[model samples]
Target: MPKKIAAGNWKMNGTRASLPDAMAIAATPAGDCAVVLCPPATLLSQMGTEGLALGGQYCHPNASGTHTGDISAPMLADAGATYCITGHSERRADHGESDADVCAQTEAAWSAGLVAILCIGETLAQREAGETLAVLTAQLNGSLPNGATAENTVIAYEPVWAIGTGKVASPDQVAEVHDALRAQVGPEMSLLYGGSVKAGNAAELFALENVNGGLVGGASLKAADFAPIITALAAS
Candidate 1:
């Protein structure tokens, strides 16, 4: 079975005070999905090793220092991070990361042996214009590294409109896109859905064909909300 995924993107949230949740989730029995947590770079090592695997919020394209604010992929790996999110919507919108930038970051990720959670999504205007798939295709085509593989690539489709917007794509709509992406990347690739993946709709979403797992945001902050979503992902 393709390991079901339950990944958390901590974004700008979490502090040294937030260590407890990682501990709890690590202890929870994961059924089928390979669970992961991407906290701020400050917490990766402190988050521990036994059960929880670590991830990084973002990583620089180069492997060396002097970039100042940027964290390199090798640094992430050194911190014990197993995965790292690149090209997140926030990075695209806030920093204006071009497709080439995302591709560079993707390559750097593999160089450091960290799986890249490559995020690509369309805004509401694009979705309304019936450009959803085309936008995704273009982003995938431009951002994916030439040496992509299932072991190191995980695509996250986080509708820019729904992220932190309390809105989620219906199961059917999400499935339509995920299935399309599967054909694009081949069966071995894992297509993950993000954007307000709360406990309430997780099981409904998980039931859909090709709906492997989630890249949770706000809901992942609290074990109360994140736990139920993890429970829902257990293979039926």
Candidate 2:
């Protein structure tokens, strides 16, 4: 079976004042699940809590370079991060990152001994046109680098329209995508559902076949909001 994980992407949020929430989350018992917190780069080093894993929101494809202000996978590892997110929709859309770029970043994460949480998803328009599976499959094939394994990589499907929008894919939608991903990646690879996941709907989502965990957003900012989701995943 794949490892059950409850990962929180704090995004471009958090500060010294927000450290307490991370601490509180780390204090929560995760049962059989592993809890990871990917805070903003500013807090990744400081968020080395004992029970929770630390990760970087993004990383440069280069190990070390003249790319000013860009953090590399090696740099994240040096700062105590054991995992790094690559190909997040926001990065793909906002920064115009191509699938080739994401594949390079995934390889960089592997070189630095960090697990790459590769994200893939479709926009609402794509979903509306019934092209969700094709889109996801293309992104997965394009963004995932060669030599990826269950141990070194995780797949997160967060629909572009649902992220931070209080919209979530239905259980049927999640099952279809996750099932397809599982077929392609094999049974051992962990698959996570993201986008508007909260305590209210976590259990149902986690209960679905092929859903190993979740990649949370806003709810992750506070332990009070995120802990319940972890507990739900543990139960699943």
Candidate 3:
């Protein structure tokens, strides 16, 4: 299996002042698990100096262009991002990003020598309709680029309804999806669980068979909150 990873996605929520949190996270002993922080673009270069793996929240499919306000994968790499998130639920819902767009962007990330942490999940309605597996399979097929390998790609499963909603999928629920995802993506690919993951529930979730680590959001803003999750992954 790929080395376990605990990646924190700061989203649009940090500024230069937030480097202390990154420093604190970097200060924490990581053991065998990898720790990554994806701060906003404004802080990427600054956080890069903190001695932790850095990532970008999003990137454009193109290497460079006059897309205006869009950061390309190469730009992110130049800024010290080793990984870039693609097809996050927020981007899909708010920006209308499609699976094809994610695939292209993933390829761009790989081209730039960055790993792509591709996000896929089911909406509450879709889960209720018993379509979670189908939705995940389709997203996996469409968003993944050709020639993807365990070293260059990671998958994050964040149930749409649970993200920031203070609701976490039960271990059984998480295991169900992760098991299926592992089967689809192959056993070597690192799989992460996202959405409402807190220190309180981190260990239980990490103990699940196919759950390698997490793509943390709100809890990741502080080292105190995020460190435990990292510890849980390392212990797992």
Best TM-score goes to which candidate? Answer: 2
Residue 53's lDDT within candidate 1 is: 74
Query: What would you estimate as the lDDT of candidate 1?
Result: 0.88
lDDT of each: 0.88, 0.96, 0.92
Say which prediction, candidate 1 or candidate 3, comes out ahead on TM-score. 3
The residue-by-residue lDDT of candidate 1 on 165-201, one tens digit each, is 9999877779878988989998887778998998889
Write the residue-wise lDDT of candidate 2 on 1-236 in tens digits: 99999999999999999999999999998998999999989888888879999999999999998999999999999999999999999999999999999999999999999999999999999999999999999999999998999999999999999999999999999999999999999989999999999999999999998999999999999999999999999999
Q: By lDDT, highest first, what's the ranking?
A: 2, 3, 1
Candidate 1: misplaced stretches above 4 Å? none
Q: Tens digit of lDDT per residue, candidate 3, span 1-236?
A: 77699999999898778888899999887788889999998888888654589999899988887899999888999989999999999999999999998999899999999999999999999999999999999999999988999999999999999999999999999999999988888889999999999999999999998999999999999999999998888888
Estimate the lDDT of model 2. Answer: 0.96
Q: Judging by lDDT against the true structure, name the best candidate.
A: 2
Q: Point out the higher-scoring one by TM-score: 2 or 3.
A: 2
